[model samples]
Target: RMELLEAFKTYFQQGVANPPGNYTSYIIKAENISRLQKLAELLTKNHIKFAFGGNQNARGFNYDRQKEESFSVGRNDLIVNLHQPAAVLADVLLEPKTLVSDTNTYDITAWALPYVYGLNAYASKENLKGLYPSLDLSMDQDAKTNATQLPLAWAFSWGSTENAKLLIALQQANIKVRQANAPFTIDKNDYPAGTLLVMRAENERLDKELAKTISKIATSQDGIFKTISTGFVDKGKDFGSDGYPLLTSAKVAIVFGDEVSSLGFGEVRFYLEHDLNLHPTIISVQNINSIDNAQVNTLILPSGDYKDDIKEGLAAWVKRGGRLVLIEEAINGVIGKKGFDIKKRDTTTKKDDQKENFGSFANKSKSNFDDAIPGAIYKINLDATHPISYGIGNTYYGLKTDDLIYKPFVQGWNIGEINNKSLMAGVVGKAVRKSLDAGLLIGSQDLGRGQVVYLATDPLFRNFWEIGKTLFNNVIFCDY
Candidate 1:
């Protein structure tokens, strides 16, 4: 308060002594006029000489004619509306990244994203005539799609009994079905019950490891055979005839499961088929327990939804030096009983008490951009410089304490201590046990012969496609 008072006194004395010339535009908001009044008091009390407009333009305070008047201050004066022209507020809040002559190029989606999108929204439309006039409408478009519909199981034979039921419903609806490896093992005499089988490319230019998987599938008695992968596309001439019918026309198709595809796999498909000039033949699998016949370069599990078999596979894979990406939910669900334990109190089972385990639907989805949440983004102090944050801002993101049910993973990430509880901004904690010296959130740990990069947030291109697209590219695609 004293500091602000002193600043006002300084400005007030200066303004009163010179009476602010017409060359300067003294803009003020309605709510902030009180500050101006305080400053006026100081000037009057000190009896300092001042002016309102300049000597040449005595009536008009020579503000730039090009700049539009944001408030109803009229003619010579200008008003700045905080809510209406928030971009101007942000412009004054965040310092723009300085241009460098070195290799440090600015990332479009990483460093200058959310703020850019936010400011662009709050900027007056008329004021932004030439700057991205096309996206003016996108600010009002509804981007939220309800995830109410239960995903149909096109290849139910590969999943559990519940999966089978889902597949049957889709089939009855005339949805195309495909069969892959079953989540559970069946008797050798068991028949193929799936709707369709999607053949994956065994030896595409990028997937050289698929040859052994294809050979294994051929020798197996699962009868869950698939056609040649459309990923092979023209490389395999018999797509319509011998290629995976699911890729071409099956109303319901079963592809491989992966952590990267947990949210929207359609974008990758679009990119592959259109942007990258390649066909996408893989399917995203939530549970990896059924994929024994295929060989994968990396096996990913997005936190809490893991099975015993999947864990076993992951353990073996990690031991054998394969890549694995595990989200926070998976770590809490499978590995240890440490972090936020949503498991059970004493002894509780679903059959014993229906209210005990309500499944994934019980938890509500937390909004990342909601301003109601305090500390939607926590400032992370990192170690020196790292690769993950090579091109990102000096600060990283954390969970907002304001979000319902979402809690932070770090101690210093909290906003305030209230009622004996620490209110933090970031959710989802990663388990770290290491002896080496490196950064925590954006650090890479050498596991066995391979490496594991631990990012607090799922920087997957799929999740933050809009705001952090370039950041994702730097982490996933860039060799640097």
Candidate 2:
């Protein structure tokens, strides 16, 4: 058990360790913003060394827009978000390659660290069920066999083309291989449908050496193969087809300006460039007039302050049949300024002018752009039939950190909606106001021959919320 636990720990550490990068960022979401702030404080008090937004007085450093801090716990370069729920980016030492493989490393690490550290804090505070670290070791169960009489043949599923290369590499290394007559299943995972199994006859010395080599390759950073002791057999269940549909590349341009905040821009860029494998050109908002619409299919504007001219130019581009994707604060910039006018829902507390309490209530009616929801999970009703909702289900969960209270759209379709039950955190009691009433979460407006896609809250927020990735992808790939 100790050995297994230690291996698991090493596995997780390697999974999070930076991969040839200056800094490694981890996104963490808690039930509420307070819990996340507390975790940041705890890390600071413990001399863990971190940086965050909002609380500059904390033990760790505060995020400075100018400085380039390398990911180092010692240097106190970790980035945390306290004003809104965001993913935390910290420096992680790159573990030696021999220690652990990098297969699905970032995805696994993102999920694991939050569960280990962030969720633990929430679990302790709210008395919620804490997540326990686990590894699926069912493969070990199939390996129990007589040591000398171990099966010589190995089977691999046709899940990936890389497995074929593995077979060739083994043969070139002098491991004898022949095709087996039958297909087999191990641990309920069916092998290739073509009865394609590679066999190496059990020669005492050769088989033992081959086993060691196979084990080393399986656990190596480059290998994706998993081995079982079972020999090849005939007439086993097929593991399904290993094919993917070819997708056309869309030219995506993201608007970046000197005045724009890097928080949302950075996260959106990271997802598009790294996760989605889409190379989007970073178009300056100042250079909006210089863009050639023919070269760009989709233009994304991250939540940030924009000049009226930039908005006017983008609005013109949308009218020329270009697809514009607006996120968070960007929604306000385009609305009313351009042909799109989405009025803010009246969330003001009613004030009786004749009453003595009017003075206090009048002060609260002022429009506050800083209004936010903060660390809440809201269910988004997706119109799957819409081009933007392609490949997505009927409903999806959106992390609503910002409250975009817009009046009913005068034109276009509401692709996504947030219902009353969608509220999960941040707002409570009377503070919830009329904003919680069924409101538009996502909508598209037709502008001449083009379209404007508006998302109320960030879907690829911090790149931690994996549920909304498809929705974001659809936005990138959808034909306007």
Candidate 3:
């Protein structure tokens, strides 16, 4: 799919190391759709050198045919198959060993396979080691020997799909991992069913190394991994003190369509299914009228140009006790609609009779607002007492990739707001002041028996901003 390819390009550009003269080849095997067209366009826009070939079946192209078809193809360089049944291309493609294989090369393989599969399959460390000898996959021998002793363990909630990926990645790196047989509690926080327990012997040196590997993969800018050290315990009296409620029954629906303007749809979908472990149903705008509302409790609208009919259906659903989460451009779609708006006050007129209320205002008038700061990081002050802010501290970091800013809604309860001096770049001399209506990063409003949540910028943008993940999880689990 084009969405998958776009996400791959973003990951390659931002996270992976790009060496000189190194090229990547992706083997896509599926029915050609509009997504494939988009993928071709994205590859061209990025100037990524690539070749495309496919047929009605797997036997259409043989080894000689593939080579003859593309004379530019080389055998010595690395090659990656995006999806399986790799047997379709295996005859023509070079093996990993035949193409300059090493630990670094294997490392890329480990990351790339996971990216392609997303949340579809799970690969254990032993399986990975058996497959790739170049991977220096080895678990601490003492750790396995002293497994029952008072060893240090890292506990990750099973609800997070990102955690699952991390668990797999760690395993691929030859680290020892296990799921808690029972519910466990660390400090005051409760971990639910299927919580991953990353354990190692209490060797300070090895522990630090393990931490580094996780940090490299997780990449939470605010240092989420560092904060877990204080709560480490093997068999404390407080173990399993409290149980976290499972959100398995809660169903979340994400809107997707043929809208050409849609952005962040793949990121949102990936984060929900892969990071949050919430398998969300993809609802197309064309079929919105046919779907049953009772099956879905929460609906997510990603940044896109939505049809008016789709917007009306969502609005009507929210009024009937269905929760709505609007991100970026979708925020504008629900403008002047029920339970989501800025509630702008007239600043020009003093007379009560001439007063008027508006939903949105221009951001250029504000001295603190910067127009579209790409990759800018900002601090978000969270209301810890609120359900959506549960388990999150007073403040966490959020990423902004757009220019949109709103005059904060005074009447609505402030669930999360941008902190003073929150600007990370652009116009460095200008001071970011706290205003009654300045940077309202996130807010909630009661609509009938349900709730409407609005986010000015995407918290799960590219699934890179790790600190905002808990807040997004809260949105999924919180009862509105």
Taking all chains together, the TM-score of candidate 1 against the true structure is 0.32
- The collision pairs in model 2 are 25-89, 27-87, 71-91, 182-233
Weakest ten-residue segment in model 1 by summed lDDT: 429-438
Which residue pairs overlap in candidate 3's backbone? 161-274, 161-275, 161-277, 162-275
Q: Rank the candidates by lDDT, best first.
A: 2, 3, 1
Clashes of each: 31, 4, 4
Question: Candidates 1 and 3: which is better by lDDT?
Answer: 3
lDDT, candidates in the order shown: 0.29, 0.49, 0.47
- Worst 10-residue lDDT window for candidate 2 reads 121-130
* Candidate 3 displacement at residue 202 in angstroms: 36
lDDT of 1 by residue, 1-480 (tens): 999999867764554343221222223211212222333343345442222211121122111122333433312112222222122322232222212232212222122222211111112222211211011212112211111111111111221112223333333433443332111122222222122332233223343444343333323322222222122222222223432224112111123344433443454344334432334335355444333323543444443344333445444544454444444344334334222212211222236433443446433332222122222233334332233332233433332222122222242222111111221122221111011012233333444543333333443333322213323322332121
**Superposed Cα deviation of residue 392, candidate 1 (Å):** 1.8
lDDT at position 279, candidate 3: 75
Instruction: Give the TM-scores of the predictions, in the order they appear.
Output: 0.32, 0.48, 0.45
> CA shift at 230, candidate 2, in angstroms?
36
Q: Write the per-residue lDDT of candidate 2 for residues 1-480, one digit (tens) a residue.
A: 999999876654553442222223322333223224434555555444334322122221112111232221222222332211111222221110112232212121222223212221111111111122222224433442222234544443221112333443554455543332223556666543222243445323565565556655444412333344543323453322221112224578988887566878898889876654456899888876566788996888898876464646666777887788888788777656757755566666566422343445444533221243334455567776565554334565565654565665777787888666655323322344346667787888888787788888777767655445546765664344
